[model samples]
Target chain A: MKHPPLLQAKNLKYSFNETGTSTHVLNDVSIELFPGEITSIVGPSGCGKSTLLYLLGLLDRPDSGEISLNEKDVLKCDDKKRTILRNHKLGFVFQFHFLIKELSVLDNVALPMRKAGKSKTASYEKARDVLGKLGLLDKSNRFPHKLSGGEQQRVAIARAIINSPSLILADEPTGNLDTENSKKVHSVLSKLAIEENISVLIVTHNLELAQSCDRVIKMRDGRIIE
Target chain B: MAMSLIGIVLGIAFFVITQAQTSGFEAFFIRTILGTNGAIKISDRFQDMDGTVSKVSKDGNFQFFFRSREEAQYTEGIRFPDEIRNALASYQDITGISEVLEGTAELAGSSRSFPVIFQGIRYHDHSQVSELNNQLIAGAIVDFAKDPMSILVGNRIAERLMLKIGDRIVMKGGTGTLQLRIAGVFETGVSQIDKKRIYIHLSTARQFKGERFAGSFFQLALDNPDKAPELAAQIQYHLGHRSVSWQEREKVWLDVFKALRISSAITVSSILLLSGLGIFNVFAIMVIEKTRDIAILRSMGFSRFDASAVFLWQGLIILFLGVLLGSFFGFLSTYFISEIPLRIRGIFSTDSFVVNWDVFHYLWAISLASVFVVIATWVPARRAGKIQPAKIIRETL
Candidate 1:
């Protein structure tokens, strides 16, 4: 029994316009991620790895493309529907933790569930459970500012996975961390993909981390070479 | 947030205070006018007249002629006052009626003399129809009634002639002069009336004028002064006499007061609008400062409407707190103003500032301030919603 690809992007093209100059970022790129697989997209600087990640995350519109998430074509969806899809079917982790400083670890994790129309009690309950699994339940009541860099990134991961999303998109997830913290984050991502059967796609410049993934794709000048 | 809250508070406070001040002035003016003259007055003056004449010939051939004729003959004063009084007495709204003879005379005191408009009234009936008894600042109406030759001089008249209670004065009318003693001094707070008016017994006016002298008009008091216009019209139609409501008689002054109210409203509205602009500035700065946070929320699947609603809720919270604190401060301000004693003596006189505490003023302040707040917050909130997550994320990267 084989699993279907959780996310598929075909012939995606995107460009950036700056001061009347257009720079083509993603040029006719295509990719697919299978469920329960951790895939790494490794590239040099200015190679548009982050651009492709953002397009797959539904955070930006491509100049032209087809994106089918969970077997549903999503490019034709309006902004509101796209936002709903992002909330229900996808999760995101960025280089920076991006935790709201004012919110506690519990609240930061609970936000997605709350946005998904879950009741406050249910959201907090699930947040605590996720934080427990991430080994940060004791610090759930503490604000993000008080957390270590690795701890904050783990909290961001908890927040992303709180809604049981089918896919997770990570851009430079461990770029800002040290060796030990990066390994810890990498182990957490691999475990989430294997144990929870979630499709995890990471865009990073760390070839070591890419080599550790179940599948690795190399990109140069916006085109995947391997 | 503090700056925005302050703007809303100040705007709402100023609005409530302005409303209270205007209401106070308007109430004072209406009180003075209604007290000086009852709610309605019936006289023989011709208010509405139709002089048009129509003629029709059998064959539709007729010569039309137009001519100006002498004024139609009418009685000097309200005709059959007793009959009209009896007819109006059955009305539930008409509280009291008094016959008064108004005449002009020169009143001489020991030091000086001044021309005066004197109202000769039956003291008992007049007390029911007017606030004359309550207007007395010195002596008593009882004393004036006890002495047949006694007169009640207005405060301004007393001040001008240097007369006090029990002082000897002589009133010289068109026909004769009568020596009288001042029994009381009253102030109606109307400069014109207080400066030139006096009150005496109706019998004294009849004796001075002639045996055929009748009351000049019938003053009627009503249960509700606001209903004067409607009742006045009805009375005029029923009795065929000119009936003037207090509002109609003081039309010019009322119009002036109305204009003052409108101007004050505009002034306060402008102040609130400026305060709203302050709110706009603060929120705009907040949106800029929180750009990263907005981007984070947008990336977390918060809809554009949710982004906009975040700021709108901030505005609403500010509005709620502002109205609460502003109303409290507004009440305190009006209370303090009313307690400050300062004599104002021009067209209207008061020993202290008048402040009218009306719930409507607070409601109006809240309503007007909310409008301004909505307008103020909407711009920044919309900007917050329109923020592109990709752009912000890319910039941060």
Candidate 2:
């Protein structure tokens, strides 16, 4: 049986204008994100993996490309609508958790729902369910700073999936973690993708992490090489 | 939110109390003056007019008899109720309401004699209307109702004559030279009134002026001192003529107080404005420092509005504290300065205490200043919102 990708990036291009020069960061980048699969985009340090993640999360506008989320072009939506779509349909995990230190762990998990204007009770219940799934129910009220590296990454993962998004894009989510913590994060991500039928595209430098993904796509200047 | 609310209430308490005290004191002064004196007054050009504007005005002192028919008619003119009758019968406020008298007096020392115009006031009524309680320094007020012949001298009069209380002074009036004893002396702080005041009983004053029913001015003590202006208004209405108020009678002093009020306003505004600017600077620095926190909030699904709100909250908190602390310091400042003797090297002195504790002026000053602070905070808070979350996250990380 054949199925369409949950997200399709076709002819994705980006550039930064630097004093009358077009600094091309990405060119003709294309990939497929399918449900229950982990795709790793591996490259050198400044090869625009994070830029690609920013584009995928709709945090930045591409110079030219098509980002189809669930078969609809994301670039066509208004800012407010785009934000709503981002909160509802796409999950993002950054290198740093970027977790609001002031908010509780449960509140961090419930953030997307709160952004989506859900009631407090519904957001809290949804937050608890996701936290419990991540085996963090006991620590829901604790703040992110109170948690360790691997546990915080898991909490970040819980936060990412709290709104039941179709695709999760992690920009080196475990980049700061040690080998042991990174493996622990990888297992949890793999379990989440398989059991929840969610797709994940991770940008990582570690060849071992890439090898463990369902499919590994290598990039040098921006073009994907499978 | 609850904790934040507690902070706000505490801040408002510090705000409102200082505001009220300043306001209450201003009210007290304005009340004190307006109580003893009326708010407004109308007087004739020539202050010594009897009922009509007669060109040949009798001097402030004279003497004589009135026609019996005129006296009988004059006595029949006035009527009163029991409450009013009882107060007037006892002559509590009025030592005596009498007549204006003119005299030439000799200075006891320096032997310089000059013609002086004097009015024999019911001395008790003089104190009731004069606000002598606020007198800077005083000897004794005269007992005119008890001793019809005794007299009180005005501050300027006493100064010029070089006389104090318990001085026997001889004055040549229209009929003869009458010897009167000086009972007490008072200063009204107004130049004109303090220059030429002389008091005796209402009957003696009429006797000195020489007309029983003829008087230079109407001198009646109010039934109640607090209700003087109201009663004055009623009497003026009954008389259906242009009448004079004591405030108009003492315009120079009123003008002085008015000037005092204006200067106080200017001083308070300058101080509050400077304090507000200092607070605004504090808030500006605070927002700049919290830029990263605001960016994190924006990234955490908070809209630009929420981020701005967070900054605004920080501003409001700081301003609330500043207003409180500033007012607290302002009070302690005023009191501390007051505590140190006001007449420091004779350079500074005040009516009562620091700018006479004006409430409305200070509150208006503070509110105007704080509004500027609030507006000033907006620039920084909006700048905070403009900070990009990803850029901040990248930069901070």
Candidate 3:
């Protein structure tokens, strides 16, 4: 039996205009992320790697594109419908580990679950189990600011996966970490794709991190080269 | 947040203090006047007489008195005093009725002559309606009622003339002059009453005015003073005399008090409004500082409404806390301020500042705070909600 990729984007295009000067950011970019595969997008700065990920994660709109999650077209969804799809099907990890300073680590992780209409107990128990898997259960009560950069990034990963989404989209998730912390975050994302059969797509400048992934999409200017 | 909360607290405290002081002044004045005037009075421009008392040319106080009989005589004021009194006597709402003979007279002391208002009454009937008897500081209350020539003098009047009880003074009125002895001196705390008013027997006042069966007005005290206006109207319709409620007689003072009320309300509301502006600034800065956090939450599936709600809750929580603390401080300030002794003398007298500790003032303070905060919070919350996660997320990338 043959099956389609878990997430796919075809001929995605986006542009930004500055005072009547048009700059094309993404051009005819097509890519597929399969289940149980850790895929990485490698590019230089301003290479549209993050833009393509944003379009795939439904965080942004493309000038023209065909995007599908489990064979359902996502490009046609409205802001509200796109948000629901993002909540239920797509998880995101930004570079900064943008955990809310006002909330404790456990609350930050459980926020997505709570937003998904899960019970408080169910969300907290799930969040606690995930934090324990990351060896961070004991530190769940601490605020994000008190934690080191690597721990905060791991907490961000826990938050991303708490909704149990099929696809995890991480944009340079460990770009700010030292080698040790970067290895830690890379191992967590690889484990999420392999152990949980989740489709992981990462955009990063780390060549080793990209090469260790199941697939790597290289890009220049606006179009994917491989 | 602290600054805004402090603003609210100070505003409410000032409001509480001002409201209490204004109300205290008004109450003190009204109470002092009511002690002398009763709750309602029925007065007629024309004197009660035989035949007809006609308006000669109707200006201010111009009137023509005509007697039909060859041997002419003048009767009392108020066309049907007996009928009016008899009609009002049985009403359950009416507590007491005193026939009043009020006119200005000259008191010629041996050394000084002072102009005074002579208020004549049947002592027992007047005592039931007023606090005059209780205000008698010296001499006997009986002398003013029992002896035709005996009068109750105000303390200020007696002091000005250097006259004491049993001192004979000549009272000159429109009719004639007569020798009257001061029997009592009263102090009402209010300077106007103590300086310009004197009480005498109704018969003596009539004799001094050279009119028998004459009454200037009837002072009626009701069991419920709040019903004065309605009762006054009813009594006026029945007796065909002009009636005035206690509130009506003090309309000028009430107008001035209303202005004070408006000014106080403006003061409180403006302070609350400024507090709200402070809250708005605080929340706006928080939203801007946490722009990336808001973006991350939205990326984590928090909808715009949810993002907005976070700030809304923050604002509401601050408002609730501020109002709670403000109310406590406001009440405490009122208590402390009311404890201060203030002896104020004007149209009325007060030994201390009067304050109304009505719970409604607290409720009003809270409501005002809520209104301002909600308005203050909405703008920042809406701005926070409108922030596109993609814009911030892309910037961070």
> Top lDDT: which candidate number?
1
Over A71-107, each residue of candidate 3 has an lDDT whose tens digit, in order, gives 9998888888888888888899888888888899999
Report every candidate's CA lDDT. Answer: 0.86, 0.63, 0.84
Q: Clashing residue pairs, candidate 1? A: none
Give the C-alpha miss distance for residue B275 in model 1, angstroms. 3.3
Candidate 3 at residue A124, lDDT?
A: 97
Per-residue CA lDDT of model 3 for B127-244, tens digit only, reads 8888887788899888877787899998889999998989999998768898988999987777878899998888878778765544588898889888887677566544556567
Write down the lDDT that model 1 would get: 0.86
What is the alpha-carbon lDDT for the whole of candidate 2?
A: 0.63
lDDT string, candidate 1, B1-397, tens digits:
6876877687778878877888888888788777779899988744333221123355876432222314533456765667887988988998889988887899988867899998888998888888888899999889999888999999999998999889999999667899998899998888888999999998887787663334489898989999897787667656766677999888998888788777887888776787788889988998998888888788788999998998899889988999999999989898998898978766667999887889998998889899999999999999999999878887887
TM-score of the B chain in each candidate versus the native B chain:
0.86, 0.61, 0.83
lDDT of 1 by residue, A32-129 (tens): 99999999999898999988988888889999989998889999999999899889888889999999998999999999899999999999999999
Candidate 2, residue A181: the lDDT equals 88
Q: Find the candidate with the highest TM-score and give its number.
A: 1
